[model samples]
Target: MTWRASVLTIFPEMFPGPLGMSLAGKALAEDKWALEIIDIRDFALDKHRSVDDTPAGGGAGMVMRADIAAAAIDATKARTPAGTPLLYLSPRGTPLTQGRVREIAQGPGAILLCGRFEGIDERVLEARDIEDISIGDYVLSGGELGAMVLIDAAIRLLPGVAGNEGSLAEESFAEGLLEYPHYTRPREWEELAIPDVLLSGDHKKIAEWRRAEAEKLTRKRRPDLWAKYRKS
Candidate 1:
């Protein structure tokens, strides 16, 4: 089945933005995957089409209404494939990982809810049993970008979406490493030369060198990942 991504957001125009220009775009055009854009405002009950309001007990910003969010989610869920996971993009959610992206990509697809302002009401998330996922620790103006980031990541993993399937296996996080540094032509550029092992064309030695470099970089740059890699 074609991998699918449904995004529900207040800003519908933001979607298929960057996702419409790169490898993801190519896959989309080829029907390797599909994108569904749902405007949250379309579910608003108010005459002004407002979807958010002042947080209960007072807060700094408006919170998205639970009713509207539920309405949008339910409508989308009805049309999407059964068992497709529903995800809400939030800073407090579990940090997204390559493993999770792979799992989602292998599934039927996902329904992403892009929260705005302070965020969607907790009740809707609880009632729908939606999973919250964070792209990173930092917060953005809204979840639209997060939704796009997630969709793009998953789409590339769909079969036939990537031009170089072999390269995907060596990409960063493919094996819980940061990935070894890469070098290109102009083998000797300025002062740097392509690693001798790479130029030697010895697959076995090249692989060994790459593993070592990946380990070194991971240990120095992401001790968290390195620690997990070691334990595993």
Candidate 2:
């Protein structure tokens, strides 16, 4: 089945090439999936094509007009089946995880809403079927980057988006731990030799060594993930 994504943003041109450069890009080219960047301005009602309005309480930044954003999301969502959910990228959302991205990848399609200024009006979410997703704890100037990050992570999980099926398991966070060290080319680089285990040619031993290294790296760099890994 083909997986599709619809992105709603004020700046649609910021996408395409960026998303087009990675696995998601290749997926779009190969027809394994489809992605449509819908400009919210297209649904604007005014001559100046204003999609945002001054805050109701006189805030410093303008707020995204609920109706305009809602209309854009609705239009894109109607093109998909009922099970597909619309995702809004927000700083105050559930932190994204590999499992979540995998879940989204299995869907028939999805809609991504990119909020700007002071963010889309809260009423938009109340009126539509949507969930908020945050890539990290940090705030971003806009949701465009978050949407792109989400799409890239989801696309790679699709069949063939990743050229090496084995690679899916080795990448960082694939199984909740960081990836192990990798070595290539000359046995020695600048006098730093490749790991002896990798050169041993014993697949079982190599796998074991890699796992050990991955665990170590996770423990040192991401204790939170390491703690959860141990619990699981």
- The candidate maximizing TM-score is 1
Q: Which ten residues in a row have the lowest lDDT in candidate 1?
A: 155-164
Per-residue alpha-carbon lDDT of model 2 for 48-93, expressed as tens digits? 9999999997869999999999888878877777788789999889
| Total clashing pairs in model 2 | 0
- Report the lDDT tens digits of candidate 1 across residue range 77-108: 99998989999999999999999999999999
Q: Which stretches of candidate 1 lie over 4 Å from their true place?
A: none
The C-alpha RMSD of each candidate to the native structure, in angstroms, is 0.8, 1.3
lDDT of every model, 2 decimals: 0.93, 0.89
Model 1, residue 217: C-alpha shift (Å): 0.6
Score every model by TM-score.
Answer: 0.98, 0.95
Q: Which stretches of candidate 2 lie over 4 Å from their true place?
A: none
Clashes of each: 0, 0
